[model samples]
Target: GYKGDQIRDFFLTYGDQGRDVTVNLASGGSPQWYGDPQTEDWEVTLVETGTGARIKRVAAYLDQPYFLQTYGDGIGNVDIGALYTQHVASGLVSTVTGVHPTSRFGEMHVSGERVTEFNEKPTMADGWVSGGFFAHKREMVDRYLDDDPDLLLEKKPMQTLASDGELGVFTHEGFWMGMDTFRDWTELNGLWDSGDAAWKVWA
Candidate 1:
């Protein structure tokens, strides 16, 4: 049902526009289906370790001393440049953008152009959670992660980093949402079509 040529053509069109985007299919355990990456533009980034490596797995592929990282399925309007600058100034090994994700279902009283009151989901008052936008020092990976692919980046490394004062945080008081449900998908599509998506950073 899927035509590889058509997809390749679509990619080529984008490539022609000077977009140096590399589509990587990461397959673990034993490489099946996608045996090898044939084109120079696209590649199969292989991770031989078992599974559940999470950020640690992806971090290994990066060659930069510091690289921006974010969840592919999450959308946010965080000021990335500010976060990077803060990270550099703090001299921390890792920095996660903390955010107050909009409440899923809540009641808000808006007067004129301001919200008078909102009683809903846990906000920044409840405490901040990792927004998935990160600036990581690549060398920290080897210091924190091991060969075990089952390691979760959030479990020990992050905690240890925080405990050792080696981690920094940038709070984002802007729009943020994770697309995880059908409702989220529909709403994101609606927002995209409406041309009012707050996370449209380029605009």
Candidate 2:
């Protein structure tokens, strides 16, 4: 697992019953998972924190656009590879993809010396890092903010870093998902409520 203090700022969870806790974006949009009703779902691993019960990590199937819109603005923009390229070219980032490349989804092709390309696939590691539920150091946050005032930590910095080859990635050997639209949310939620969600971590 990634280590750092800034990880505290990235996720949110709510509990209604012992087994009815819900997790989603902490600061933006409605607090619901996004994507296809049948496939867009999350598996939450809870751990004890100083604050109380908190999510350790989440295994999620998300809708790309919805995830980007919800968390993307905070980071910068959601184009993982493009954002990183921009940062690297401008000296805004130092390391890209902290973890292995295989941890990422979507089309991320590395071309000639220091050149990379991103495809239209929704969840690729093009301009962003593999940060879902991962932790971060407080120093990283300070470095990120000091560089860009308009920076949305979740969206812009990762892209900026990737552009500069300073972003780090955490490859997870597990299931993942994304939901990009309202319809996707509906479908995923229906499946979750029906107890057939493939991404369910509760039961």
Candidate 3:
């Protein structure tokens, strides 16, 4: 509910794009939408829940076998259908998109106190981190998550799922970036402006 008002106003203005929206609030009240919502087929429900409680709260309103989850700060061209296919094929409760992020500083390969190779801020070649894209079975909500206000999906929940052999990873070797800081924001905007944003796979 950090930007509850702004989010509500945005959906109220342009949420009729074939899908319904439900804005969960941490505060305990549902405010009315002004004017007509412009759609008879779509429904919008504004309710009370925070990040920690979002998965459980949202799952309560859903009747599907699979649910998608991701952080709002990251953008990527991850193939959702492929991810879901992998998740189901693995018979896992959760599948997270793993990405190789770029290193922030210059990289140097040294041999006996001598620099053998150097690359400036190269993409990490050895490890993958969560790109924040996720595909999950609805069972994951009840089985791996909880209602505690401090329950983080990336923490105990994911760890427990991994320990239980219910977690899978989809390796995404495409463009992915996280807008966590001002520099990242600027860089992403620059990519868009230059028409070099690899994540723009749709028209």
Looking at model 1, the pairs that clash are none
Local distance difference test scores for all models: 0.74, 0.39, 0.83
38-93 per-residue lDDT for model 3 (tens digits): 54466666555765667787776768898777777898999989998898888889
Per-residue lDDT, model 2, residue 16, is 18
Worst 10 residues of 2 by lDDT: 65-74
Ranking by lDDT: 3, 1, 2
lDDT of 2 by residue, 1-203 (tens): 23323443333322212233245556655544444333325553333233211111121322121111122111211334443444345432233322212232356567666538766434434443342433333334444443333434446565665565655443433334445457557756787799767555443
User: What's the CA RMSD of model 2 in angstroms?
Assistant: 16.4
Compute each candidate's TM-score over C-alphas. Answer: 0.67, 0.34, 0.80
Q: What is the lDDT of residue 13 in candidate 2?
A: 23
> Model 3 — which ten-residue stretch has the worst lDDT?
31-40
Candidate 3 or 1, higher lDDT: 3
| Model 1 Cα lDDT, one tens digit per residue, 21-87 | 3444674344223233334445434333334655566665787778776655688888999999998
Q: How many clashes (backbone N, Cα, C below 3 Å) per candidate?
A: 0, 53, 0
The candidate, 1 or 3, that scores higher on TM-score is: 3
Most accurate candidate by TM-score: 3
Which candidate, 1 or 2, would have the higher TM-score against the true structure? 1
Ranking by TM-score: 3, 1, 2
